[model samples]
Target: MSSPASSPSAPPDTGTRHITATILLACLGVFVSYLPVVGVSVALPVMQQALDASTEGLQWITDAFILPTAALLLTCGMVGDLYGRKKTYLAGLALFCLGCLVCLTAGSVVQVCVGQALTGIGTAALLPSTLALIGHVIPDPRKRARAIALWTAALGLGLSLGPVVNGVIVAHTSWRWIFLPSLVLAVLTAVLGAVVLTDSRAERERHLDIPGQLLAVVAITGLVYGVIEGGSSGWSSAQVVIAFVAAALGAAGFVVVELRSACPMLDMRLFKSSAFSGAALVMAVTLFAQVGLVFALSEYFGLVHHASTLDIGIRLIAINGFTVVLGPLVGRLMNRATPGLLLVTGLVIGGIGALLMNAFQAGTSTGEAALVIGVLGIGIALAMAPITTIAMDAVPHRLGGTAAAANSALRQIGSALGPAVFGVILTHRTLATLPGHLASSGLSPADQGQVSGLVSNVGIQAGAFLHLKTPASTGQAQAAYGASFTDALHTCALVGGIGMLVAAVIAVALIGIRPARSPQTAPEATAHPASAAS
Candidate 1:
């Protein structure tokens, strides 16, 4: 296909109208791509009832989308560079819309998983293309940076709003209706992009690294599958063991292939720069903590606190919603503070928030939880943009697109791992403590048997506990289940808190201030010369 840059359809002038249209389309593209990820977290309880899905099934619903997106992101970016960004982006929107339709009509959890995987494939193409198109259309460096900041804000807005939108939908209508808005937005974005976006690609020929891509897919899938299944099946089960082993082999093969490939999906040399490596590590750990915490808290609010879907969304907004306001402010702070300093400060604050959440009790109020969540929101807002800037700055401009993809892929991998790991912890802890809680209750043998039967097969969702009919039994069951759920949430909070603390330490040690350079020196050494520290 001919590059969009070479097409005769280029706009006569890069006027205000053209730029606004391009930025809005890019924002919509990003917003729709991320909306479903956290939105589904709020809808998991409803899904469990509607589809009779297990906890593992719910994890698969999220991971099925995340795994493909993480694995294919770099490859898709390269495809956009070699082919045409506009073409790939349009194709992604179409595929995403198709996936939404399948999900809307899904009758079973397996069908939902299939649809999620398809949507993930579409996102893999959409994300990188959106960013690449911005760089292509906005030739001026200052304008390009501003446009990218707006794109970042849109991403944060989507993440923040997903739960709120899903909550409203679930409260009033079926959770299936959640996809309708996204579908509509996707169609609008596709139409606008076709009219406004200029076609563009890399100046040089690029080759797809199929073997490396396949290895990455297999490795992430195996590892996540092992984690998710190990919680249900015994950890030492044959299936879990085989999955872990296969993941190890796939990971090893991926490293070897990338090191040797002429056109690697991920250039291994990026890791040689401590700033790049530190930024990438921060991205992974932050998402790990953030995503896992959101999943665990969503369950806590719904099952333990008996909050409605809208209430749960409002509660979560305290944690995620601040990004919209704080992102651009932090972007401005990039001029005053080193990216390393900003990252360290943000991680520390986020860690403190997680630690505070660990103090939650069975009777904790929504107001109390929101207080800590707001703190986390601020921390995340401070860290996210700076880390992105640092990672992009660490690479040469020529590799800027690749660097962004790599950072995003690692972040998605962390996102996928978070739910799996936290879910395992939540499930195991709840199960281990349930018998004790039940034994202490003044229940007759019949009631005990009934409650045991109800809870033994399900996760910590309220649907299982809500089945108790008698008032006395229901009260006892709620108390027991709430206590167990609180304990599990605390454990998850501890894990997430410690992960962020580690990230903070890594940032301090590895992310250094930029060295001083002569004014006459060429800017190629640092990818973002404008933001480089003295």
Candidate 2:
């Protein structure tokens, strides 16, 4: 896989002072993007209670960001390529800062959702441009790799630290403080970006694919909405079905349009290279498994173990901490080994770690849980950077922007879909087993249903399960609730284990053997090939 077309003219490498300033600015932008995701997740329970939000509303709060990020990523990349990348990036930060401020003052869930959307858009803008700018600014391949390594490290740090940071802020003060720090970071990054970043754009005029963009947005939004709604309304509901259908149709239209357009938003031709296709497939599956695993496990620790948001964040940090260390190493490994090897090894390790995590019981020791999660983190660390590097390497220079955008979009979608799909599984499993688990414990049928219902909604963390507020006949209800909660977690663990095993197979078979050759080979196919492959 080769890089996209070279920039019309590369920016000259500046002295250390300028490089340091520019790199710092770019890192800051990434840090700001990290704020909303980790910050909001920590605040989810608070947001739900404070706003009197329904399950649907809670889902929306999360979907609001994922939808926009997935929808707008390609468009933002195109915009950066067309206009000045530096300009587009700074503008994104400004919008993000404004959105954070809006979140601070949001009186309702709807308002917060809107603010989150804006933050998503800003994130979309920042993502591709950072890499594009790095490619532009650092002409040397080795130097560029190093720069990218630093950039990725910042991202790893931001994602990992985001929850911990929010945990401290939310615990000490209000959730509003989570948004407050972002305001300052956004402003600082924007200003730094303006002063330090070099202006870069495609010298040639590239017409915007308006219809393709619109259809892509519709498809992504519908998909995100459908996934979010499916959890509460049931996947069988007409509302959920319509949303999924709309998303599918819109996505189909997008494909049709891209195939026909002279300059498509997504060049479908990139799949020609077996290497590119392999890497992309790995990316999608890896993300699906990784994102889903994190969501399920985090909720399990918090709900079943009765951990606070801060405690949950700290526990999760063990996994992400490995990410921080492994991210740069993966980048360095790209210099010597095939990305395919790294991808296969990483996924297998991660899958194994996930399987081990399935052994966690409700009464499992904290040390055991932490060990399982830490192993999973090691896998994440090993795989993520190499996967990204492979995808970027797969495309040519001009398409780099699009390829990067698509990569980010798919990951976001995976992130969004993970929770919803797994949440459904968890809910169903809890409902099915809770009654039986509690029935023989001598609780009243009515009490069994109510306690089961609570566990279903919040998993095992519901305060009612902890004896904080028991029914009038409390003894039986308490024991029954505890047993039911344990049953729910057991079910989730088994299902999650199965998912990891499947992902491991795909990684091994689909990704196949690691390339002995250089990554610069032509992608198996072009973005818009004239001849169709059978």
- Best candidate (score: lDDT): 1
What is the C-alpha lDDT profile of model 2 across 133-159, one tens digit per residue?
A: 765655444455556667767777776
Worst 10 residues of 1 by lDDT: 525-534
Give the number of the best model, judged by TM-score: 1
Q: Per-prediction TM-score, please?
A: 0.93, 0.88
Give residue 440's error in model 1 in angstroms.
3.4
lDDT of candidates 1 onward, in order: 0.80, 0.69
Q: For candidate 2, report its TM-score.
A: 0.88
Question: What's the distance in Å from true for residue 325, model 1?
Answer: 1.2
Candidate 1 TM-score, true structure as reference:
0.93
